[model samples]
Target: MHGDRGLTVGGPPNAQSPPSAADVRAQLDILLASPAFDVPARARRFLSYVVEETLAGRGDRIKAYAVGMEVFGRDKNFDAQNDPAVRIEAGRIRRALTHYYLAAGLSDPIIIDIPKGAYVPHFAWRTEPVTDGPAATGPPPETPAASLPPMPRKRIMWLGAGLAALATVVLLVMVFLIPSRDAPVPTAQAPMPGGPTLVVMPFADLGGSPETKIYAQGLTEEVLSQLARFKELSVLGRETSRSIPPDADAARIRRDLGVRYVLEGSVRTAEHQLRVTGRLLDAETGAVLWSQAYDEDLRVRGFFAIQDDVAQKVATAIGQPYGIIARSDERRTQAGAPEDLEAYACTLRFYGYRAALGPASHAAIRTCLERAVDRYPSYATAWAMLSMLYLDEDRFGFNPRLGSPTATQRSIEAARLANRLDPENVRGLQALMGALFFTEQPVEALRVGERAVALNPNDTELLADFGARVGQAGDHRRGMALMEQALVRNPGHSGYYNGVLAQLAYLERDYERAQLLMRQVSLEKFPLYHFVSAIIYAQLGMKSEAAEARDRFLQARPAIFEQWDREMAKRNFRPEDATLLAEGARKAGFPVADTTAAETALRTAAPQR
Candidate 1:
C-alpha cells in the first residue's frame, strides 16, 4: 500500500531483527531517510528497475521487460529481447550506478552491478559481517520459528526453471524476427553502443576517353562528399583512402582504420552510360555484407539522374551498416532558375580571390561577383562574397585607388546588405562582423559570433572567421583556441590558421616563435599569410626575417603608398601597425623614406564632407 508521503511494507521492517524480511525493510528505510540517497524522480525510477532486475536474476527476464514497459511506456512495436536500444539503456543505467556511489558519500554500503550480456542488475550486501568458518556451530539462541522464512522446494524450483526456459525461447525468436538493430527499447531512447567504419574507394576510369575520365572523377568525389555528411559512420578522408592498390589487404586496412567494415567499388564509363559495382565486406571474417551493381544511361536522361543514384546507394549502404541515422542533407539540389548556378560559380571564383592579392586581383573578384549579383539579385552567396571583397579592401589595405577612410564606410554598407540577405550564411555573418568591428560596433558581432559557434560547433569556416575577428578585437586567448579547433578539423588547410597563429605568437611577446613561423610561410601559396607574417616578425626584433617578409609583401603588393592611403581612411588606424612594417624595412637597412611616405599618405586621406 502507498500513501501521499511514504509507504510501509511488511518485509525486513527492522535492521536489528536478526536478518528477517522485516530487517531488510528497516535497512532500506534507513537508506531512504539519509540525505545521501537524494536522487531525482526519473533517476530514482531508473535505479529501482536496476535493483529489482538484479535481485530476481535469470528466470525474471520478462519481469525486466515489464518494468521497462510500465516505466517508459515503450513496448509497442519493439521487442526488448533483440533491440539494441535495450542494451544502450543498460549502459546509461550503468553510468548512473557509478554516479550514485560517488554522490552518496557512502563510506561502507551495499553495492550492485549489472553484468554485460544480461539485462538484469545484481546486488550484494557489503555491510554483512563475515564469519571465519563455513557455518556456525548452532542456530541462534533467540531465533523464533515465526520470524524465519522457508527455503524453496523442489516443485517451486522446477516452476522457476520452466519460466526461465520460456523467457529464453521468446528472446531467441525476437532476435531472429527483427529486421534491423535500430528497434527502440522500453524506458529510454538510447543510441547503439557502436557502429561500422566505411571508406569510399576511388572509382576506376573504365577505359574511357579524357572527357569520360573527368566525369568519372566527378562521380568519385560526389560519393565521398555525400558519405562525409553522415555523422553516424566513421569515413576515411579522400586523400588517405583513394585507389586501393591491387594487393591491398582489406583486413589490414580495416585494422589500421579501426573499422569492422570496408566498402570497395569500381566505375566504368562506356558509350554515354555509367556502370558501377559496389561491395560491402565484414573485414574481420572476410564476409561480404552486401554487393550490388548499377547501370545507368546518362546521355539519354542527363548526369543529374546518375548523381542521384550514386547518392542514394551511398546513403543506403551507410544506413544498412549503422542502423539508420545516416542522411544526405548536404547533397546539392537543382535550382529552378539558372542564375543560382551563376551565383554559386561566382562564389567559387571569389573564393579563388584568396590566392590573388593587390589591386588588380581584388578588382577582378569584385567585377565577377558584381556581375553575378546583377544577374541574381537575391543570390545570398554572391551578395556575401561581394561584401567580403569590399571589406578585404579596407582590412588588408588592398584598394590603393579608393581612399581607405571612405572605402571602410563603403565596406560597412556592403556587409550590412550581405547580412540582411543571408543571416544564416557564415560568410555573410563574418562580413557583417568585420564591418561592425572596424566601424566601432563590435559588441553585437562578438556576441553573435559566440552564438554562431554554439549553434554550429563543427563548422571550421565559422570557427576560423570568428577567431580572426575576435583576435583583432583583442580577445587573443579565446581567438587562439577557436583557430586551433579549425586546424584540428582540417589539418592540411593551414594557410589561414597559420597566419592567425603567427599573430598570436606576436601577442604573447614570443619573438623567436614569430620569426620561426615567418620562415615556414609561402607567399605564393597564400599571399595574406605573408602580409600578416611580415608585420609580426618586424615587431618581434627579427630584422632579417622581417625584411624577407617585407620584400615578398612589397613584391606581391606594389601599390604600397596607395594601399596605405586607403587603410588610413579607416577609423582607429594604429601608428604601431605601420611602424612594425616600416621599422622592420629600416632595421633590415632598406630605404625608410618610401615606408614613411606611404604611412603619411594613408593618414592624410580623409572623406570629403
Candidate 2:
C-alpha cells in the first residue's frame, strides 16, 4: 500500500508482521527522543500534532489553516494563503525525516516517511535479505533443538552460569549508558543588537512581462536602499533578501535571518499606469503590521514617487516619525503639476550622484541640478540643490577653477533666488545658511539655520549641520543639545555627528569625553577630526598621543593648517576664544603662528547695536 503523497507502506515477504498501535506509539516516542526532533519547540509541536492526527485517521482533516490554528496557536481566523506557517513547517519536517533515516535510523527494523505535499505518514517494515533468484523454491532444513553438548559436572556448570549471567547484566548497563545517536545538534541564533532588523523582500511581478519583472526588481532594490538610509531602522541588504521564496512563511524567515519584520509587496504595470501594493508582517507571529496600495501613471517619475511613498509608509508603520510624509504633502500642495515631478526626479538623481563622491559624480550632480533649474526656474527645491552643489564643490575641492570666493558668490545668489521663489522652502533656507556662513556672516547664518531647524526638526542632516555651525559660533551648550537630540532620533547617524559632539565637548573643556567622542570620527574622511583630537589629548596631558594625532592630521592634508586659519579669520572668533584654541594647539606640539594681532583688531572693531 502507499499513502496519498506517494509514500510506500508494508514490508517484504520475509519481514516481520506490521507494527501494532502500541508499537507505533513506542517508535514515535523513541524518534522524538532522538536529535532529529530537536527543533524549535513550536516545530516539534507541529510535527507531533500532524503525525498523531494522521495516526488517528484524521489526515483528511489536516488542512493548512487547521494546523496553523490548532498546532501553532494561531488565531482561528488565520488566512492560509497569506500566512504559510503550516506549509513551511511541513517542509522542515520532511527534511528532518530524511536526516533521521540517513543517520541514526539507518538500520531500524521499521521506517516512517512523510511524503512531499502532505501531512500523512507512511509506516513500512524493513526488507529482509534474499539468497536466490525467483527460479529457486525450496524449504530450508531446521536445526534440532534436542541436540546439545554433554552437560558439565554440577558445581562447575553452576559457577560458569553465574559468571555468564553477570557479564550479560554489565553489557546491558553499558548499552543504556551510551548517548542516543539521533540527538539534535544545537544551533545558535544570530545576534541582533540594535533596533529591530527588517528585510524588504523582492517585489513580485504581477504583470508577467519581462519588462515588468525588471521594473519590479529595480523597484525592490531602490526601496531597500532608501530604507537603509534611515538610521533609526536596521535594514537587511538586498543581496541577503532578494531570493526569498514567494510563499515562504514568517517562521521560516525568522528562523533563517533572525529578523523581526518582513516587508513584501507586488508591482503591476498596465497601459500607462502602475500599481504597487505592500504589506509588513511580524515574522515571529505571522501577524500583519501594515499594508497599503498605491496607484500612479506609468512613468519613471511616478515609479520613484511610489517607491519613496512606500518607504515612508514602512518607516511610519515601524514607529518612526513620518517626517518625509509631511515634506511630500507640502510639496504636493505647493506644486500640483507634472513639471514639479520632473524637477523632483532630477533632484533625486543629483543626490544619488552627490553621495558617490567621485569627481565625475560631482560634475554629474552639477549637470543634473543645472538642467533641473533650467527646466523649472521657479522650483525652489531645484535651486536649493544647485546652491548646495556649489557649496559642496568648494568645501571638498571638487573643482580647481571654482575658488571659495566664486563658489560663495554663486551659492548666495542661487540660495537668494530659491528663497525668493518660495519663502516656505526649508531646504532653500538650509542652503542659504551655509552660503552665509561661508561668506563670513556668522550671525545671519545662525539665524537662518535655526529657522530651518524650526521648520523641520526631524531632518537629521540639517540638525547635525546646524548644531556644528551654532557650536562654532560660540554657543556650545545649545548646539550640543540639538546634536544629542538628533542622535536620539537617528542613533546610526553619520560620523560627522560624532565629530560635532566632540567639537562641542572640546569647547566645554571636557577633555576626556572629547577624546572618546573623536575616536568615533573617521580621520581620513574628516581631517579636522584629528585636529580637534590632538587639541583634546594635549589638554588632557597626553603628549605622545597628541603629537601622533597632529602628525596624522598634517599627513592627511598638509595645507589644512593654513586653510583652518583662513576659515577661522572669516568666522571672526573672539580674541580670548582664539587665544585659548591657539594656545591649546601650541601645547599639543603644533607649530603655531601669531594671530593675536588679527584677533585683537576683530575684537576692537565691534559692530554697533
Candidate 3:
C-alpha cells in the first residue's frame, strides 16, 4: 500500500489524568497564554474574523456544536471545537476577559459565558443600582438589562462602580487585543514526546468569494508543511487527505485515513487582512480536541508567518510543543518561497484530471506537471506525479512517437529523480517502481516498492502496487490478498485499488470478477476507469463490444499502440479470463482487434514488469 495502511485503531488502557482542579488551573494558565487568547499579529487576524462573525448579526443563529464547521468550513460531522488545543484557547479567552474586567472597569462589568451544549458564546451583564453619592451614578438608561436587579439606586451605584471597573478593564483589553471570552477551547491530552500522528484537513475559504479557494488551499499546505517538522509525529501528507471533499462524512474520513484525530480550518483573505481558524477533532468520538483562530495583517509581514503560528498552536494543544517536536532537523523547506507557491497550486489540480480528462487532456496534465517540475525541481511529489502522468499516457497508448525508446527513458528518469528527491515518499517510490517494472526490471521494482511500504507501514497504495506487481508476475494468490487488504483500508479508494484488483482478477482468469470490480468504480469520472473496462471486455468473448470499447479507448488515446505487437492475452493471466472475455465479445458481436496487443499491455503494465 502506498499510503497509511495497517494503522492501529484502538490502543491500550488510557493513561490516567492528574488531579483535576490543580491540573485544570495549570492547563488553564497555559491555555490563556496560548495563541487563541493572546492577539499576536497572526492571532489578531483570527480574532478579527471571530469578532466580525459575532457582530455580523449572524452570531445569534450560530450553534455551539456546529460553530467550528460553520466558521471553518469543515465537514459538519467533524467538530473542531472539541480539540483540546481549541478548548484550551477558549478557556484562555474566558479567563483573559474575566481578568480584563476585574482590572479595568470597577463600576460596570460585562461577562461573556460559553454555556454547555452550545457552541456559540453567550453574553451577560451584571449591574448595581445607583445611589445619591458621587460614587453613585444614575443608570445608563438600560437598567432593566441587568442580570442581578437587587437594590434600586444603591445596587445601581454598585453596578456603576462595577461598570467603571469593567471600563478600565476594557482599556487594558484594548491594549492587549484579546479574543472574546466566550471563544471555545478544544480538549487535548499530552502525547509522548517523540513522534505523533496528525491529519491536516483542507482550510475553508471565508473571503466571501469562491475565487479565493487557491489561497485557502495554499494555507492548508502551508500548515501541513509547518507541522511536518516533528520527527515524533507521522504526519499524513496532503496527497492522501486533500481530495476529501469539505462536506464529506467524518466517519468516512476516519475509516479511509485510519487516523484518530483530524485537524481542519478555514482561511479568509480580504483587503489587507487574512483570517484563519483551525480545530483538531478526535475522529473516533467526533469530539473537538482543540481549536483556535488567527487573524493577521497580511500587508505587514505577509501570511507566511501564520504557518508557523498554526504549527506552534497545534503543537501546544497536543501537548507537543513546537520547540520540542520541531527540532532543527524536522522543518521542511518553507512553502512561502515563490516557486513553491506556484508548484503547489499546480498540484492542486491533479485530482481534477483524474475525475474528467481524455488522452489529450492527460497530455495537457503532463505538460502542467512538467511546468511544476520546472518551478520546483526538488519537489519530489511533483516529479512522482509527472511520472504517474507518463505511466497513464503509456497505459492509454498515448506515448508520442509510437514505441519510442525515448518515452520509456523519460518515464524511468522521472521516476528515478522523484525517488532520489524524497526517498521515503511512497508515491515517488511507486512511480519509480512502476517505471522500472514497465521496462522489465521486476527485481528492482519489487525492491523499491518494498522500501516504500516500509517507509509508510500503513500506506494502502503501496500494498496495492506491490500486489499488482505480484499478480502481473504470475503470483496471483499472494497479490490478490494484498489487494484485498488495501481495499479494507479505503473501501472508496479511487481506481488505484480497483484498477489493481481488475488487473489481477483478469490475470487470474476471474473475468466475471474483473468485470464486477470495474463496474464498482466511478467509471465515467475516473480517468483509468475506461482503460480497465477495456481490458476486461477484450479478454472475454464479446469481440464486437471489446472492439467498440477499444475504438473508444483509442480515439481518446495517443498513438502508441500502432506498434504494439505482443501476444499478452495468451500469457500467464488467468486462462479463464481470456476465455470469458473472448467468448463474451463473440456473443456480443463486438470487434476484438489484435488480442495479442491487449495481452502484451497486461503483461507489460505490471508493477514488477
Candidate 4:
C-alpha cells in the first residue's frame, strides 16, 4: 500500500529487439513533454535521471536511497526505510506514465517504463504501432481510406462498434492494473490501501484424513487471528476464499481479493510425526518470497500447543513491523502523502516522524494528523498518533505554537478518545500508556502497557516503547526482557532501542555496560541520550567526557537544571536514585541546587515520610 501496489510484476522481456538508444531518448522526451505528465520538477528530474542512468548502464545504482539524496534534495541521513518521499513520487510517476500512455503516447514507437518494485527504467519497442513506413519516430499515419476496399455503411458501422467496445475493455483493464493506493477503498470487504494486504488461504489437507483436515482448518484460522492483531496489515479472512481450491493460482487470489501477499500451507501426519510446509508469496508475480517447512514430533508436544506455536511464529515472521512484507516493501518505496487525508495514511506519516523525531518532520506530521482527525473524527489510529505527537511536545520540546492547548492535557484527551473509539487497538492503549506515564501515574501506565503488549506482542515498536517506559518506571527485569525480544524480532530496528537500553544500564549503575550500549546508539537530537551519557561518564570517572556530555544536554534541554527534581520525577527515578543522579550531575559540572529549593524539598519530604 505504500507504493506501486497494483503494478503487475514484470515478466521476461519480450522477443522484440530492445529499443535503440535514439528511440529510448525520443520516447523519454515525448513522455516528459506530454500534457498528461503534469508532475512536479523533482518528480520530473527523478524520471530523467533514472532513464538516463539506465541508458548509460547504471541501473544497478538506481535505488530509493540514491534517488532520495540525488534527486529529491534529501541529505545523506535520509533513510529510505523510514522516509517514503521517493517511493511516493515513484508511484506518482508511474500513474503519470499510465495517463500518458492511455491518452498521449498511444502510438509511440518505444515504451519506457519503470517497472513495479524497482527504480530502474526499462525500454522496449512498442508492438502496437507499426506503419506502411519503416521505423518512423512519430505517431503512425492514418491509412488512406481510398487504398482499402470500401465496405457497405452497415458493415462499417458494425466494425466501428466492435473497435469501440474493444477500446472500452482495454480502458477498464488498464484502470484496474494501475497502482492506486491513495484511492478511496471500495468497502470494508476490500483491503484498505493504508498497508500491505494478505489472504490466509485454507491450508491443504494433503494427508486426506479427517483429523488432518481439521488440523489444517484450525491452523489456518489461528494464523488469521494472529495476523489480524497487527494494526498495519489488512488480512482477508479465510471465509473470503473458501470457494477457491487450495491449489488455486496466486494470480487468481490477487485478482479476486486484491491482496499483495498470500500465505498458504499444508499439513501431513505420519509415524507420530507432524510436518507443515508454509510459503509466503508475492501475489503480483506468484513468486515465493519466503517459505519454510516445520517438523514436530507429535509425541513430544500436544497438538493444540503445536498449532498455537506455529501460528504465533507465522504471524511474527510476516505481520510484525520490519517483518517479511515490510522489509520487502521497504526495499523499493511504499509511502505517499495523498491529497485527501485518510486517517490510516496519517498514521504512516506519524511513523515517518517517529523514526527521526526531528522538529521539521514533527511539525509536518502534527499538521497532517490534525487535518486527518478533523476530517475523520472517528479514526482511532489518527487520534492515537496525534496523542503521541502531543506528548512529544513536552517530551522532546517540539511544539512551538503559542496559546495552544497544554501538551499534557491534549495528550491525555486524545489517548482517551483513541481508546474509546477502538478498545482493542494496541496503538490506542500505547498512547494511553504513554500519556499516563508522563502524568506521574506509573502504576496505571504499567498496567495499560502490559495489556497493550498482550493484545499485540508482535508490534516491535510498541515492545521497545513499553520497555523504555517500564524500565524508567522501575521494573527493570521485565523491561529488559521485552526490549531484547523486540530486538530479536527486528534487528534493523531504529537506534532508539539501543538508546533506551543504554539508559536502563545507566540506571543500574553499570557504568561500563552503559558506556558500551551507548556506543551503539546512533540517534540524533535526543537530549536524554546526552543526559544519561553524562551521568554514566561521571560515574566512570571520565570527567572531561562527562562535562562535554553535560554541556550538550544543557544546550538541548537547559530547563532540566531549573527543575531538577521535577525532571527526575519525569524519569520516575526512586528518591535515593534521584539524589545519586543529582550528585553525578554535579560532578559533571551541574550547578549546586539552590539552598531554598533544597529546604523546600526537605520540608515537603518530612511529611511524606
Which of the two, 2 or 4, has more lDDT? 4
Per-residue CA lDDT of model 3 for 1-609, tens digit only, reads: 211122122211112211122222232233223222222222222233344455455666555344445443457577554654344334434443443344432333234444444434443333421222354466655656665433432234345545545744554344233221111111221111112346778888777555468768777776676556432345677866677788876666665555546788887877777777878776766866567777777667755566656545544444232122222113221233233234544444453454354566667667777775654344566677677677655554554545444555667666766665456666788788887777767778888887876665344546677888777766778888888876765454545667678867876668899888877776555544454577677666656655666656555543433433331321223434443445444344334454544455556676674
- Cα-lDDT of candidate 3: 0.53
Candidate that scores best on lDDT:
4
Highest TM-score against the true fold, candidate: 4
Candidate 1 per-residue lDDT over residues 298-363, each given as its tens digit: 767777677666755654454421122211111111223233244444554454465344566788
lDDT of 2 by residue, 156-272 (tens): 223444554564455435434422221111121111112345788888999945577877887788677656644434577676685578888888887766666888889887777
Write one digit per residue (lDDT tens) for candidate 4, span 99-124: 46655566554567889899998876
lDDT of 4 at 235: 75
Segments in model 4 whose C-alpha atoms lie over 4 Å from true places: 1-194, 205-215, 268-277, 285-300, 326-343, 525-527, 591-609
Models ranked on TM-score: 4, 2, 3, 1
TM-score for each predicted model, relative to the true structure: 0.40, 0.43, 0.42, 0.62
* Candidate 1 structure, TM-score to reference: 0.40
| Model 4 clashes, total count | 1
